[model samples]
Target: MLTIQFLCPLPNGLHARPAWELKEQCSQWQSEVTFINHRQNAKADAKSSLALIGTG
Candidate 1:
């Protein structure tokens, strides 16, 4: 498994457009993908835009 951790550099963060872009990129992967919001203690399946929006 590959793991990475980073902060959102964008002022508006994720929203919808970027979230869809991210979802598209992650879709190319064969492994499971997840978004972990350390500050909010939230976890979401990276394939879902609605779940990612909450982490923002």
Candidate 2:
């Protein structure tokens, strides 16, 4: 498993469009991916649309 922190470069942060694109990119990777918002104590599957949305 590889942990990656995806910083939101957009002013709006990881909105719908970018989030979907991120999921697509993550899905292409061979390793498992997961995203965690340390501040919010939130976690999500980096490859799932629903989970990606939860990151926002």
RMSD of each: 1.6, 2.2
Backbone collision count in every prediction? 0, 0
- lDDT, candidate 2, 1-56, per-residue tens: 44456565555446777778878988998887887766557778888878867765
Candidate number achieving the greatest TM-score relative to the actual structure: 1
lDDT of 1 at 19: 83
Whole-model lDDT, candidate 1? 0.80
Q: For model 1, how does the per-residue alpha-carbon lDDT over 1-56 read when each residue is reduced to its tens digit?
A: 78988687776457898888878888898889999877677888888888887786
**Error of model 1, residue 49, in angstroms:** 1.0
Q: Which residue pairs collide in model 1, if any?
A: none
Estimated TM-score per prediction? 0.80, 0.71
TM-score for candidate 1: 0.80
